[model samples]
Target: MTTVHGSSYRFIWFGLEMVSLFIHFTCLLPLLIGTPVTRAFMPRLNGATFLGPSNALSPVNVAHSRNRGIFCMRSNEMITVEGVSVVLLAGGVGKRMKADRPKQFIELLGKPVLLHSLEIFSTLPGVNRIVIVLDKSYRQEFSFLQEEDPRIVFADPGKERQDSVFNGFSQTLPDASVVCIHDSARPLVSQSAVLASLRDGSVHGAAVLGVPMKATVKESADGEFVLRTMNRSRLWEIQTPQVIKPDILSEAFALVTEKGLEVTDDVSMVEQVGRPVKLTMGEYTNIKLTTPEDIGVAEGFLRERAEGKL
Candidate 1:
C-alpha cells in the first residue's frame, strides 16, 4: 500500500514539472519571433523632428514609430497627476489667537492645527507634495516636529500670503502640474471640496472654493450709517485650496511682482492678468480660525470626525 502511494506522488510531481516547462516555452516564443520582425521593420529615427515617425511612413519608419509609440504609451500610462502639491500659508503673527505661538502651531486634540491641515493633504492619495509656508522666526519651532516623509517640504513665509505662496511655488517640484494653496488656519477643509477644486482647476485654468452669502451683506461708512446693500446672491465667501496650473501661477506671481500689487490670494494675482478664476462650491464648515471662538468650533469638528460622526 505504501509503495503504491509513493509511486502516485512521484508521477504527480513529474506532471507538474512538465506543465511548468510547457508554460515557460510558450511565453518565450512570442519574444523570440517578435524581436527579429520588429528589428527588421523599425529603423532608429533622429530626435530633432517635432513630428513622430508616424508622419513619415516608410515600412522601416512605420515599424520604428510603432515600437517607439508602444514604449511612449507605456510611459505615459505610468505617469499620473493625481493629487496636487499643496502650499499651506501659515505665517501670520496670530494677533487674533493672542497666543505666543502662531495660531497654526496651537494644539488641537494633542496635535498642532497646522499639523492637522498637513495630515489631511498627506493622507490624500493624489497629494504628492506639501509645502508649509511658516514664519521665519518660527523656523526652529517648525523644524523640531518634522516628519521623515519625503512629500513634506518647508518654506519660509513671506511678509504676506501672496509672498508666502511665491516662496512655496519656488520650492514646488518641477514636475508638478498643479498647485493648491490653502490657508493653514482653515483646518476643516473637506477632501471632497479639495477634489472638486482640483477638477474645476484642471478644466478651467484656475479655481477657488467659496460659499454663497447666507446673510444680507451691507457696506457702511460709519458705525450707524449703511451706505449700500449688496446683492447676496452674487456674493460668495472665499475659502482655501485654491488651485491653478503651475505655469499660470508662476505668470500671475510675476505679474504681481511687476505691477507691485498687494493681493491676498493667487486668484487675485491671476485676475490681474485678465484670467477668470472659476469657483467650486465650498463647505460652510471650512472656516478660517482667526479668533478664539473658532478654536472651539474646530475642536468640535475634529472630535466629530474622530468619532465617525462626519
Candidate 2:
C-alpha cells in the first residue's frame, strides 16, 4: 500500500483546493476525467464541451445530464477511515409484483429479499452500521433480523420512499462520514460496486451505481406511436447502493423538501441542486425485484454466482 507522508498532507490538500476552485470557475475537466476506473469507459471529450461554455450548470438539466454519465471525480487517498453507514430501503409498495407482502419480504432462494440485501452489506469491511427501513406491518412478522449483529438496526417506513430513506439517514451511526443508500429489492449489488461508490462519493460528494444501456430507446407522446428514436450512447440504467457524504445528503434532501420536488433516487437529489455526482459501473445482474418475472431472473443470477459462472 502507498503511504502519504505527513509533510505532504498539506500539499495534497492545497492541490485539491486549487483544483476544486479552478473547476468551479473555469472547467470541470478534473471531474470529467475522474478516477482510473471511470477513465476505462468515459470518452475523452473536453469537460467544457460536455457542460457547454457556461460556467454554471442549469439546475433542471444537470441531473438529467449527470444521469446520462457526465459526472466523475477522483477521490483522495490519505483520509482516515471513518466507517460507513448504510441506509437500506425495503419499504416498497410492491404493487407490480402482486405479492401477499412487499416484494422485499417475499421469499427468494428460501430467504426474504430484504435479508439477501442485508447480507451483501455485511460482507464489506468498511461497513459499520446498517439502518434498514421496513414495512411497518411486515416488521411485526419477520424473523430476518432475529440473529442480530451489533451493526444491525431497523427504522420505521414512511408514506413515500424518500421519507423512509431520510428516516434511515437520521439513524446513521454518529461517527459515520460516508452514508450509503440502497434499495432492498436489489439484492445483488456487488461488493466491488459498493466500494467504488464509497471512494468516488468521498471526492464527488455523491456517487451512484448504474449500467450502460444496451438496447435502443424510443420516445412516444402517447402509448402507441413512436415520436423518435432516442440516443442510447448517453443513457444508462441506474441502480443502487448510492454512497454519499452526510452533509451533501442533508443539503440535497433539504433542497428537495423546500422546493417540494419529487425525486426518484438519492443521487438525483444531489444532481437537482446543480452539484456533481459520480457514477460507478454496476453489473446487470444487480437487478431490482419489481415484477414476478424479475424473481426468476434473480434466481438465475444467484445460481450463476453460486456456480462461479457470474
Candidate 3:
C-alpha cells in the first residue's frame, strides 16, 4: 500500500509541472509573435501615417503593446473628427464695475475671472484652440495665462466688442473649424452650453445662447411715460458662447465690414447675412458680471455649487 501511494504522488507532481510549462509558454507566445502580427496589420509608414516612437505598432518591437490599440484608434479618430475653436472677447473696459482692472481681469474667488472662463474651455474634450482678445496694454498679463495652457492664443483688441470679435476671428482664420465667441465677463458659462452651441453649429451652421425675458419690457420716449409694452415671450436676453462655422462667420463679418455696420455680437453679423441663427436655452445664473452687485451674486453661486445646490 505504501509503494502504490508513492507512485500516485509522483504522477500528481508530473501533472503539476506540465501545467506550469503550458502557462509559461502561453504567456511568452504573444511576445514572440507580436511583431509579425503587428507589421502584418499596420498600414504602411509614410508622411501621413508616420507616428515615430510613439506610434501604436512601436510597442510590438518594445514588448509593451498594451496601449497600442488605443494609440491607433485615437490617431484614426482624430484624423476625421473636426474640433471646435473658441474666441473669448476680453477687451471690455469694465466701466460699469467701477474698477481700475478690466472685468475679465478682476479676481473671482481667488483666480481672475478670465482665467476661469478659459479654464472652462480648456477642460472640454472637443475644444481644440482658444483665442483671447485683450487690450493691447495687457498683452503681458495674457502671455502669462498662455504659458499655463499652450492652447490659448492672444489677439489685439479693437474699439468695440464687434471689432474685438472680428480681430479674434481673423487670428484664427487659417485653422478654426467652428468658432465660438464668448464674453470673458460671463465666467459661469458651462460645458453643456458650450457643447450645445458647438453641436448646433455643426448641424445648422450657427447658434447662440439666450434666456427668455421674464420681466415686462417697455419702450419710453420720456422718463415718466411708457410708449409701448413689449411681449416678454418674443424677447430674449442674449448671452455668449455663440458658435458658427468659420467660413460662414468670415463671410458674415466681411459683409458687415462692407456695409459699415456695427453689431453687438457675431450672431448679429450672421443675421445681417440672412443666415438663420438657432437659439439654445441658457441658464439664468449664467450672468455677466457687469457691476459690483453681480460679484455678490457670483460668490453666492459659487457657494451654492460648493454645497451641492447647483
Q: Which residue pairs collide, candidate 3?
A: none
Q: Taking the tens digit of each residue's C-alpha lDDT, what string does model 3 give over 49-103? A: 3232323211111111222211122223322214668899888888999998888
Each candidate's number of clashing pairs is 1, 0, 0
- The digit string of per-residue lDDT tens for model 1 on 1-310 reads 4356888999999999999999887667658777543343333444311112211111111111222221111111212235478888878778988887779988888888988887777766666678888766776776754556777778988777788888998888787768989988889987757656765676678989988889898999896989999999999988898999998998898888898989977899989998889877888889999888889999999899889997
lDDT of 2 by residue, 27-91 (tens): 45545576444344333333312221211121111111212222222221222234789899987
Error of 1 at 66 (Å): 26
- Give the poorly placed runs of model 1, Cα more than 4 Å off: 1-83, 144-147, 222-224
* Consecutive 10-residue window with the lowest summed lDDT within model 1: 55-64
Better of 1 and 2 by TM-score: 2
